[model samples]
Every structure is written in structure tokens, then in C-alpha cells.
Target: MFDGVARWWDGFELWLAQQWFPVQFVLVAAVLLPLCVGMAWVIHRGVEAVADRLGRLCRADAAGNGHGVVDEGHGGRPDAVS
Candidate 1:
């Protein structure tokens, strides 16, 4: 099975190499570029969401509020004693 897959891949690569350079470049730019960018965007958004949730959790813990309600000017830190 692995050998067959490798052989198929090799054939596909050879066929790709035989294509005109411009065609290959256009295919990559038109198809692969957008695909990579979209995937990156999705990953970045997912990471940002996780970070936001973690930040809220930390803030909630620090404030002892349990609700993650970040107050103004303190930046999620608990109020200081006068």
C-alpha cells in the first residue's frame, strides 16, 4: 500500500514538473496561496479565542469575582489598598 502510494505521488510530481512554469506558478498563487492564508487566519483566530478565555479565567481568579468582570483602569488586577 505504501509503495503504491509512493509510486502515485512520484508520477504526480513528474506530471507537475512537466507543466509550464507559468501554469504552475499561477496554480500555486491562485489556489495554494489563498488556502495557506485562510488556514493561517483560522489558526490565528482560534489561538486568540483561547487566549481570551484564559485571560478572562486568570482575571476572574485574581479578582475573586468568579465572573471575569474586568474593572476599568486596573487591567484585570485587583484593587489596591489605600
Candidate 2:
């Protein structure tokens, strides 16, 4: 199976190498540009998801009393407002 796949790939590579310059450029760009954009979008979304999760964790840790206020004193406890 692997040998068959390799042989097909070699033939494809040779065919690409024999194409005219403009045709080759268009073919490479048509195959690669969308792939690059898709990968970048996926990476961006993954980073955004991780950032959102970390933000939520930090907010939860800061808001110890569930009121969303971080205490600047009293050893990191929730602040009490009168």
C-alpha cells in the first residue's frame, strides 16, 4: 500500500515539475493558500479557546465569594462592602 502511494506521488511530482511556470505557480497556490489559511484559522481558534478558559479560571479564582470582587487585602479573600 505504501509503495503504491509513493509511486503515485512520484508520478504526480514529475508531472508537476514538467508543467509551465505559470501553470505550476497557479497549481501550487491553489493547493497551498487555502491550506495555509485553514491551518492559521484553526490555530487562532485554539489559542482563543485556551485564552478564554484561562480567563474564566482566573476570574473564578479571583472572585472567591462568587460576587466577582477580588480582595486587595485580608490574604486574598473576598472584599466586604458595607
Candidate 3:
């Protein structure tokens, strides 16, 4: 009863495994790994820029709406948006 189905699966499983061999290799070693590294670099740069801007704000002595006032001490850093 189950003999025909079992035989078919035995042949098909080998072919399916061979086809998926390269797909699994490329997904981990070529695609996902590099994308993870690139995304991390982008995030690091973005966070650094925000931190630098915040540091400038903390060190300055701005009056009014934190705009127009020139920060001569810090080489005129631009005001952060509200």
C-alpha cells in the first residue's frame, strides 16, 4: 500500500536536496552576512552624527528658539531642530 509513495519520495528527495544545496550556501555566505555588516555600518555612522550634534547642544549657551544665535565658541555649529 505505502510502497509506491515511499519509492517516489526516495528518488525525489535526493534531487530536491541537490537543488537546494547552492541556495542555502549563497543565502548565508553571500547575501545575508554582507547585508548585516553594511546595515550595521550605516547605523553606527547615523548614531555618531546624532551624538555629535547632541554634544554640541549640551556644550553651547544658546538663547531664544535655539536658532539664529551663532556659536562662535564651537565654530558655529548649526542648531538642532525641535
Task: Please tell me which predicted candidate would have the highest TM-score against the true structure.
Answer: 2
- lDDT (C-alpha, whole model) for all candidates: 0.78, 0.81, 0.71
Candidate 2 Cα deviation (angstroms), residue 27: 0.5
lDDT of 1: 0.78
State the lDDT of candidate 1 residue by residue for 3-76, as single tens digits.
99999999988987899999888866898889999999999999978887887778767669556555656554
Query: What 10-residue stretch in candidate 2 is worst by lDDT?
Result: 73-82
Candidate 1: pairs in clash? none
Q: Sort every candidate by lDDT, greatest first.
A: 2, 1, 3
Query: Candidate 2 has which clashing residue pairs, if any?
Result: none
**Relative to the unseen true structure, what is the Cα RMSD of model 2?**
8.3
Count of clashing pairs, candidate 3: 0
Top lDDT: which candidate number? 2
RMSD of each: 6.6, 8.3, 10.3
Q: Candidate 3's residue-wise lDDT over 3-69, tens digit each?
A: 9999998887666567677775765578678899999999999998998788567656455457555
TM agreement with the true structure for every prediction: 0.63, 0.77, 0.46
**TM-score, structure 2 vs. true:** 0.77
